[model samples]
Target: MDWHTLGSTPFLPPLYWRAALKRKITGSTLPEQGLRCRVRINPNDVAAYRKVCGFADSPILPATYPHILAFGLQMQLLTAKDFPFPLLGLVHLSNRIRIHRPLGGVSELTIGVQACNLQPHSKGATFDLLTTAEDSLGLLWEAESRMLCRGVKLEGEALDNPLPTPTQVSELTRWKAPADIGRRYARVSGDYNPIHLSALTAKLFGFPQAIAHGLWNKAHTLAALGEHLPAANIELHVEFNKPVRLPSEVTLYCSAPGSSGELLLKGTGDLQHMVGKWQPIA
Candidate 1:
């Protein structure tokens, strides 16, 4: 890969606009390059993230928070002219995160992002956006986010969906997801995808109404299970099954944290939005 290290994160809004233009240009293929940058955690930003995602106050950064640091790099890569897909329509299918140690005392982290694992999906093609974060000490966190570029077909067998259906779950908690949740999260996370911003913008992308950001729901679920999370060496995996429309009431359900670790978020009419679990890495 053509790797380039940057002194600061790239701005996302322009890149997003670039993506819109690139979508109209045909024959673009995934690039063979990656981006790396150094980032310092902001305590105030972490606090705001905690309040939005429902995490309890802690000096330690929540496991899901690091994705925010990696997002700009992700956008830069996806919006490049050589990237194969448009950022606006690609669906976030699954996210897998691994935390190797506590980040409470860490001040700066080196973050890297690359796209890989291009394969076929029944609906279209799928690929992985891999991100890593390391401190002066060593690698501390990483994640693999799978995205589906719908309606694209390729010359390979499609992989079966690996997310298992939930069974025998007990209600854990309910949340009223406000219509403005997308705007709130976008202000903090920098993922201003139109589908998640407002109903007017969402309809342009075929979504009947504004949809909540999948990572927001993922973070909220992790926060609910915060008491059971291990100090370090843990992995959290989640698959988005459906979108949670705006101004909706959703319920979190799981068999039990210690027993099964399986958790899911469902909206009105019992629409399953996400299924996930967290486990201590041995």
Candidate 2:
């Protein structure tokens, strides 16, 4: 918890771009943590984000959009020269988001992002980056993004997969996501990671071609599951396993509505793409 301050830094050369350029330019030692940043939401950007994420225009802000608002703050921590671990080759294991209230009424927010809780897995080392957004009303939203770092396995107990295996899943919806979906999401979310935008750029980082943003997968999945979500207080969590290749078709799946208020989405070859649970705040 070094608690580095991010004062008025521009959010250009996003996380992916910086990582691709600095994969081999890191220090032999570890980096510090607790980096923070803030921003005022622009009305125009919010509108564009809503369009890209399929959130209808309303006075109220979509629950997931706050993650997009925190993107710049996230990039700040990810690209910090002192930050440990190159952004390249880092796998997004899972994402958990909690919104205490709808933010459509709020116009400004203060974002704080911190990287903490580094633990080792059988396959690799894993960590969680926690980001919180606070407004005049107090902390309105918070999210925990989990990442896996391969080649950094440590001696410890094997990590148990919290997700249930999908057995009898039925397709809920299928659609072809265009090659440009990544770029579109990048523009709206300010996550212009090269791997998600271009094949040539992606090849630099070992991907055969460009891939969709994991957050985009979560957003679209949420849009599909909108009818089932509760109003106001909600928490959504998804673990990403495989990359959804560019210009590929996607089919969402589910088992049955359990008492847990969960909805599942699986990938081909039975790869676990995402498992989301939505519950109302009591």
State which candidate has the highest TM-score.
Answer: 1
Q: Give per-residue CA lDDT, model 1, range 30-137, as digits (tens).
A: 678999999988888888888889999987888898899988999898887777687777889999998898868877899999999888789888889999999988
TM-score, each model? 0.95, 0.86
* Off by more than 4 A, model 2: 2-9, 14-18, 24-32, 153-155, 166-171, 254-260, 267-272, 280-282
lDDT by residue (1-282, candidate 2, tens digit) is 576666764556655567667664343234566665667778898888777766667787766777777777677677778876777677888898888877667877877788777787776678888888888888888889998777664666757577664556577776666899889998898776778998988998799999889888888877666555654577777777678888877778764544236656655666565676666544
Query: What local lDDT does model 1 show for residue 80?
Result: 78
Candidate 2 RMSD to the real structure: 3.0
lDDT for predicted candidate 2 compared with the true structure: 0.73
lDDT of each: 0.86, 0.73
What number of clashing residue pairs does each candidate have, in the order they appear?
Answer: 0, 2
